[model samples]
Each structure stands twice: as structure tokens, then as C-alpha cells.
Target: MSKKINEKIQSIIKQCESLSNDDIESLPNYKKFKVFYSKKSHKTCDIYLLCAFIFGLLAIFTTSISYIGIEHVLYYSYDRIFSINIYHEECLAPKLETLIDIFRPITSCDICQHIDHIERISNITREEFEEKYAYTNHPVIITDAMNDWLALENFNYEFFKRIYRTNSSALRGVEDNCQFFPYKNKDEFETLGDVFNMDFDRAHMIDDDYKPWYVGWSNCDYSTAYLLRQYYSRPYFLPERSESSKLDWIFMGTPGFGAHMHIDNVDLPSWQAQVRGRKQWTLRPAPECFHICKELTFIVEPGEIIILNTNVWYHKTSVVSEDEISITIGSEFD
Candidate 1:
């Protein structure tokens, strides 16, 4: 971090310390601050103390309870006694984007021109991929690999509705489990039926200026995972070490809307298989790699898969086809 950025963060911390709870809650960015604070509370003093006490007492009887279980308990206990908004730093960081613009070098990477295209392969062993691309931060597109996937034939809006709508055990409308991105509003749908009922094409046909909508979710629920696994399996190029089955994610949307520019937080590289329609991805290296790496823009068509170190690259996606809906299944791997 730059000195100016550090000073700005410090100034925000000082201002936050002097603010009362009501004052903090009144800020325009309070909702974002609340989410950030909730994520951070697990690392604070109170959680550490509770974990220490619980683990200490458990040690007297049996070591049955794992550290992972204790960590989850800490995560669930979001109530904090301290009134100060520790997450005020995030609220202020967005505001400093313009002021800290001078810290980045203006020089563009010339190598980008030479590397205009991502590597495309039809058959590659898992060992080859791990050695050449996995940790080295190179991106590759694998073709002819997902030809046998049932997802290519069965996954659609109707399939999702059938699996989730009538079943009482189906998971729906959980903000952390499922998300709906409306073209105009931040409000999400309440159920899977709501998503399936959205007439994206008819809406655009009726109104010339209508924007598209998107729906995305991870297989965080057992029922959802069980249904989805019937259609798709793990990509073959992925090493055995990858926990791809455990962290699967699915994205569904009409052309014109997809994920915005952002970096993912993951311990391993990720791969996304385009099951239907098409998507254009724009990937840029992190600020540290800006000088050495060129920004890449590429299209991923149906039946194709792309693997990249998303944790190191800032990326965004857009639907490329005007009429077709895009459905992508992806997962993180070690």
C-alpha cells in the first residue's frame, strides 16, 4: 500500500472511533459497512477469547471437536460488544480511488499484443496443466472436453424450476446462497419461480431501453448440489487435489449482463465451463502484475472451458450473444 493510502485509512479509523453507533448507522454507506464488519468480527478479540476458552475446556475431555468446528462457531457469533465500526476503513477506501490514482504506473505492457489469444487445447493431461498453468498464472481454454456433459442438454430455466419450485426442501431466496441481479434495481427475487417467470426477452421487446437481468448461486445446499450433479461432472483437466465438487457455482443470465469487474477470494485456481450461449471475458493482471502482463479480452463459446488464476487477476464477464441465455458452471480447485 502507498503512504497516502495508509494515511487515508488512518484518518478514516480516527473518524470512525469518534462516531456513535447511531451516527455510524446514519451514513449512506452503512449497509456496506455492516456487511464488512460482520465478515471481520470473526477475527476480533472476543471471538479469539471465546475460541480459546471453548477449545481449552474441550481438551480436558476429548479432542473430538476439530479446529474447523471452532472456527465456524466464531464465524456464527457476529455479535460484538464494541460499538465502534471497525469496518469504516472499507467505507472510506472507495472514496479514495481518485486520490490514489497517481500510485499506478502509466506504462502499458507491450507483451499483451503478442499474447492476444489465450491458449486453446483439445486434449491435455492433468499433470501438464498443473505444471504449465495452474500456479504460473496462465489462462487456457479447453475445447472438446465437455461434449458428454448432461448439462449441455438438460440445464435450463425449466429444469431449475422443476427441481426447486414444487419441492418443499428446496433452498430459495437466501442472500448468501442465491442472488438475483436485476438490470435496474438491487432488490432480488424471493424464489426460484420468480427467476424462471422473468420474461427477459419479452421485457426487451416491449421496451427498447430495457436492460437484462442475471441470477447466480453456489451449490451451497445439498438438494441443489444433488440435482445439479446429475447433469455435470468435474472437468477432466483439473488435478485430483482440487476440491471442485465441494465448491461448485452456477451462473445464469441473458446476454448483456454478467459479473462486474472484481477479483475473487479463493485459495486455488478456478475453471468455468460454458454450457450454453456465449460470454466475453476481460481479464487484467493485478496492479503488481500490470507492467508485466497485458489485459486480455476473449470469448468463451458453448462446450468450452477456461481455467485461470482468478485470485491474481481482476476479471469481468459479459454475455456475447444477443438472444441466447448464458449458463456457466464453475468451481475452485487446488
Candidate 2:
């Protein structure tokens, strides 16, 4: 609604005009332009008439499309590191570092700080976040994995013991092994297992009492569901009302288990943070490196965060804890 954004929409419309019909059609809301014709002036002006008619039809069609699309769309001119401050017209990465430092102590919760960087770097207020960044349809960069170590050192292991005493199903964490709590949905769990190239038997092994080195639970909405398990991590925004902002939360079940390389749903970004134990993260840019990245994996330490522009590249992790609890935070962006 701001004048600056209005100009941006106009600029995008101009850019769209230069694109080919095929390209325009590939975008959402432009299918109407593929058809529809307008009236012409003179009978003798056949060629000129058709040109004028089509232009008029396209002009009206594109204008309406632009108006609607800009409401929920964001167009970035750069790739990978988008570190500029479009709002203040200044570089924000440095300020982001300052915020990280300031919140360093308070944010150290064993539930872990996943994607704290994205939250810290996001200087937008809750209102502005709702109005602008939420709807931009851009990937949010979650970072600062290293912040978790602070929380890990402060956690009271005896408190966790109290939880285990009351709830036997509550699994104790191991430092080296990846462990997870399984969900009730078998089919959805299997589907997620397939994404990780695991068979149902191998995946379901987490349900066994043998206590493997690592474990993780999978279901239709594991990420979202996991967040719900904790009372403090309620979502602040939804996709329909406002633009999608990042959803960040701590994952403090066990250690060792990690995600595999894969693209996110059509419009999402993500970052993983480590609060306790350790994880190795391998990152590859979305360029010529895509294929190699898909085949490789990485390890990250307790204090590290992996920034995943889920829209662009693939990543996988390896757990590094020996026999201690591991806590992590996962963040998603729109």
C-alpha cells in the first residue's frame, strides 16, 4: 500500500510485459492473458486492428493480475545472500549481528534456538511482519546454530528426569545417536521415510525399545505437529490471512537423527538450529552445485545453525552426540 511498493508493482508489470507468452503463462494468475481479445477500430486495418486489440486486452489483463499478484508475491533480483535492508535503505546484516549478541543470553533455552538468526535478523515489527514480509513469498534465512550451546550448558538434567519419571514414554536423549518420537500415522510416516530413502521397517525401528543410537518420529505434519507438542511455540501468522513468515521452534527429543536433502513445499524456507549435542550441516548453493549437494551430507556442532533456503538447495545432517541429550530448533519461511 506504500508508494514505494506501488512503484515496485509497476516496475514488475513492465518487466512482465517484456517476457514471452509462455513465461507469463507459467506464473500464477496470468492464464487469462493466454486467451481473450479486445475490439478493434477499422475493418481495413486488419493487422493494426488485431495488434491494437490484443495490446488493449493484454494491458487490462496484466494490470489486474499485477495488482493481485503483488499482494502475495515477492520478487528478488539476487540469489543466495540477500543481505540488504529494503526498508531502511541500509545494510542490515551488521545490525543483525548486534541483535544476535544482545539476545545471546536470554535466548539460551534447552528447547534450543533453531533459526534464531532469521528471527534476529528480521528487524520487522510484528505488524510490519504481518503486512510486508509475511506476504512477500520469499524464503526466510534461519541462522546461528551456535547459540544452542549456551542453553545446553544451563539446562538442568534433573528436571528432564522428572519428566521421564511421570511419562515413561518420554524418551531420554543421547548425545551421539539421533532419536525421535514416532507419531501415530503409519502411512504418512512411511511417506516421509521414503523421502529419506528409508524403508518402513528401518524407519519404524524408532518405535522399538532397543534404544538405537539415533531416532526420529515421522507423520503427515511432523514439523508442525512437533511444534504443537510444545505450548510456547504457537504460530503467529497463517498463510491465508497474511504472508507466510518463519515458524521457529525447538526439537528436544533425542539426538543423531536428521533430515535428508529435498526441496520444500512450493513456497517455504527453512533453517535448523542446534541447542544441545552436535550436528554436522552441509550446504550447497542453488546453482551448478545442486547435484553434488544432493549426494553429500555435513555435520554441525551444538552451537551452530544451518540456514536453508529450502527453495534453492538440498542438505542433510549427521548427529554427533555421544550419549547426552540434543536440542535443536527448526524454522520455516514463506
Candidate 3:
């Protein structure tokens, strides 16, 4: 873009143009090689032809250059080389990172110097949990926290099917009010509607020949959320001052399929209750702290709950095996 570079580009463009007869005659070899391209009879026509050829090539060049404007989504993994696209921006103001540093001095690089692993605990009082881990950016799993929830016994594939079928409003709310992540299986199930309308056996997941699918969606309706909450209660360990999210989420899938690694941009920390089957969670630190922190991986068995500050911890999940569908339900609490 400098003047020197612009001049060089113009010079290269001029060199590709056909030379005039007067210009060609100045060369010493003009008499020896009277190029047919320079014949007097076809001189004007050939110039036009050359112009057309150059314009055609330029058209292709411009088209390719314009294509770079399209948005691209990328994915990354810890300890694995993959493309990454982190898009955190504000519409009309500075980025969240800049705005954060404006108010609070960010010296959090040392936040994880002591956080070696996500702890596992049970029967913890709210005060104890808040003193140790609540909003602390440290992750932990409460092993027996969900023991009283009836969701463990009732939240299976058939229960979901029945609820959605009988409660048309809830089904409609899921489609219209929530975002559905079809993950890599968007080819077959473009919408949650299609997922529910599948054949009976496939819906029940009764056969081995069924196609693999993983999906996640939030319950958007108050009625639907209340219905689903009938089986589960707010985690007792949440701090008294903590605020719970209005939206609740469910992620279900077959073995070997789960969420991609990504950081969330949300107001509250999240807690996921592993309801039906076992799931493996892999948590990674922010890119800047990749070396300063360690990547932690663990399993959440049924009746256990895992909580983390997902706004900071890059996390992903996977069903443990082909034996059962992975089911998890949770909401965020600030």
C-alpha cells in the first residue's frame, strides 16, 4: 500500500500490455522477429483481443479477492493443532477485554498458579462452597448433589418425546425461541422438529444401525422450564446471593459425540447435572494461559454435578460409551 509498492504494481501491469509498433521497433531484434502479433492488418484487433484476455484474468483475480470477505467459523483443540476463530467484539464500543481492563486491573495470569485440578466434593454447605469455589474461577464436581432429583429416573428419551408431543407449546417454543446446535449432523436433522419426527425405533434409540446425532438446546418457555424443573431442584450448594438464569439447557447425544471446545460469553457461571449416563469433560485454560495452566479432563457420573466459570474455562463434553445416550440438564447461577 505504500507509494513504492503501488508504483511497482502499476509497472508490472503496464509490462503485461502489448507494446505499440513504435515501441517495439526501438528494440534491436524487431527486424529479425517481426512478430505476427504486431502485423499491421490485425494490429487493432489483436490489441482488443489482448485487452479482453487481460480483463478476463483480472475478473478472476477480483472474484477471488472478494471471496475473502466472507465470514469463516473455526475450531480448535488443546494439545491439537487446529484453526481457531475467537470473535469477541462490541457493536459500538471497545471490546469486552478492553472495557474490563478499564475498571479492574487484570493481573489474573497468576489466578491458576494454584489451580492444578478441578476438585470433587459432596455434602457441602452453601457457605463452604462459596468460601472455596463459588464464582472462584476454579472448577469442581459435586458427586452426590443431585441424588434427590427425580430427573435421574424420568429424564430419558421417551420422557422427552412424550413431553414434546403432548406439550405442543413447549415444542413450538423450543423451535422458535431457542437456538439448536445440530453440531456435525445438520445434514439429516436441520431442526429440532425433525429430530422429534424421526421413526419410532430411532427416536427410542433402540437399534445399533441408527445414525449418530448430538444436539443441544435451551428451554425457552416458562411453562416448559417449569415442567422440566419438576424433577430437579436448584442445587443446594449455590450461594444465597447467587442469581439463577431464566434459561435452562439440555445436551443429548450418542457416544463419541459432544460439544466442540469453545469459551462462552455469558453473565453467570454454569452448573451441569449429569442425569442419565456418564460424560467426560475436558477443560482448557484461555489461550494466553495455555502453558501457565494445565488442561483438566474428568468424568461426571449420574447423580453428580459439575460447575465451572465457563466464561474463562474453555470446555467440551463427550458421551462415555455407546451403551447409553448422554443426557445433561443445567442452568447458570451468578
Q: Which tens-of-lDDT digit does each residue in 224-279 have in candidate 3?
A: 88889899999999999988898998988778788878676677888999998899
Using lDDT as the measure, which candidate wins?
Answer: 3
The local distance difference test score of model 2 is 0.42
TM per prediction: 0.61, 0.32, 0.69
**Best-to-worst ranking by lDDT:** 3, 1, 2
Ranking 1 against 3 by lDDT, winner: 3
lDDT of 2 by residue, 138-177 (tens): 2233233233243445533343333333323332122112
- Model 1, position 257: C-alpha lDDT score: 80
Candidate 1's TM-score reads: 0.61
lDDT for each residue of candidate 1 in 1-334, tens digit (9 for 90 to 100): 6999999999999998999989978999989988989888856868899999999977842443364464444333321322212221123122232343434334233424346569889888989988876666678899977988999999876676666554335545233354333322224444445665566564333465655766676656676676777888778877768566465677887777888776665577888899988999999865755656778899999999998766666788988876667889888777
Q: Assess each prediction's global lDDT (C-alpha) against the native.
A: 0.69, 0.42, 0.77
